[model samples]
Target: MIDPLIVLLIGFSVIGLGILLVAHLFFMDTVQKTRRGMAACAALTLLLVGLQLQHLQHLSSGADLLNSGPYAFMLCAVPAAFYLFSRDVLLPDVPLRLRDLLHLAPVLAAAFLPPNWVAVMSFVVGAGYSVWLARLVYGMRRNVGRFRFEMFFFGLFALIAVGVLALVIALPWTGAPLFYRAYAAAIGVSVALVISVLLIYPQILTDIHEAARLAYANSTLKGVDVEGRLEALNSLMTRDKLYCNENLSLALLAEAMNLSAHQLSELINSRFGVSFPRYIRELRVAEAKAILSRDQRSSALSVGMMCGFGSQSAFYAAFREVTGESPAAFRKKQPTA
Candidate 1:
């Protein structure tokens, strides 16, 4: 028979590693919401792993694990974490407040109660939070787009938690060892799958942050003359060659155009069908190509620097992506004068 404890331990290890990875990436500015959501998920998974270990060691029954204070906290806090994460991703401008901790009050209260009361409290708390989460998700459904996948996952997680709370309530009275183990295994598998997806597609979090910012920017530009603004933006890029400035940024460009960073981002994304960085890269690549064609003697690195690319690697990547060839390859294809 497969050792369920071993599976739990492995799952915990994977989740722990994912937490570390997310923290590292967050520090590196790789993603916005990973710091909060991934940490909470990992912590909750670790708590469940510990409970399973306790059950395996015969130190506590499944009912005992369910009734534990930490377990109660995890039951309540996990959904709250998901909600906070979604809110942060969807509405980054709204800063997190201390009031959000109120969501955990019920489970904290259950921590001091009897086992039966704890089970009942856990079920009640989980059900209420699940409904709240579903409603929140529904409100965001229109704007979520690619982030809808993440929101869906959290919704499913909340629903599963509700079911698990019900199982916890019944497991002690029924003494169903097989069902308890199955639930434990299912939780372990679900945690592992979420962690794996987070690791593999960390960019999803970054995309959500960007999307939220873009949406905010677009909302602000609602009544403005989009055509005039786009013309002004294009003039700033082409006539002034603003893209040639190595330190050019959305904020700087927005200031120049008398607009907000979000507004400028919205203009670029809506009119040009690209993000600010990609828009800048397209300009820089165009300049680099011109330089390459006109000044064949110029070194690739020097040409890259002259065209606002900070590094040869960035220049080459953008060049290849835009032109479908390396700088040198493109240059070689040009006829000698």
Candidate 2:
């Protein structure tokens, strides 16, 4: 980076460290072992921040590998660690050896990267991890209701997907024009900030609505104790008031469930085929149907409104879309039981 950008990057790098730190203290609980990965990310971010700052100050690289060599290349761990963090937090059952190696893979790979290749590896690892997150989150969207942790983590992981995409999309095109690069970087940073706000914040944000979505949408548990786990999680959702919380999101949910957002996302996807949004929608729609089926008082209440749908139009749209039956028509055929 140049002068100002160096400062900006360093500053934001510090901010990223702060974010990782907070996540460490509170968010690393469920997947207790993820602290190592988180630590790796923090260390990388701090190092990158220093490097960026040094670059800004026009300092020449020293002979030490740590100063001029590829040691700085270890920064790839930030994204890689975050990606692995998702895995650890979401899947506590998986043994650490398998997961730990994957989490640490980037660190090991960076050892071979020459200073010139550092940027390439950074992009490769960071962008690859981002893609991994996208695959997991998008793949597991439909299973958001399967677990509180999964749903919550899926939500948070989505932000990482966007951020990683932003960086990948923006950096390659930096050759277009100075203004373009500036605009692209700004957008990427802004989106990252937004994602951090929505996904990685404190627990209060992961509220009742999210829990409800997770509860009813949960169908990933197949013929095992998984259902019991989900049900127990669902009960917690209700008691914890997760459903009503509009700000409730993945990191918060994972934290609440003592899991990482990534691990939660993987569990839902592996167990079910849908992404987080669809999973929660399934719960919402299911609840709407039950309410329509049994409650006479719900007759006047549009199917959409009876459940967790935000608006009558949204409810009707979703109901018809999912069931292939208009809300009014569906209600007409059902006997109030």
Identify the leading candidate in terms of lDDT.
1
Tens-digit lDDT string for candidate 1 (260-306): 87777777776766667667878999999888888889999999999
lDDT score, candidate 1, position 90:
54
Once model 2 is optimally superposed onto the true structure by TM-score, how far is the C-alpha of residue 244 displaced, in angstroms?
A: 11
lDDT of each: 0.65, 0.50
Give the top-scoring candidate (TM-score): 1
Which residue runs of candidate 1 sit more than 4 Å off their true CA positions?
A: 5-21, 24-63, 95-101, 127-131, 147-159, 172-183, 210-218, 222-229, 232-259, 265-337
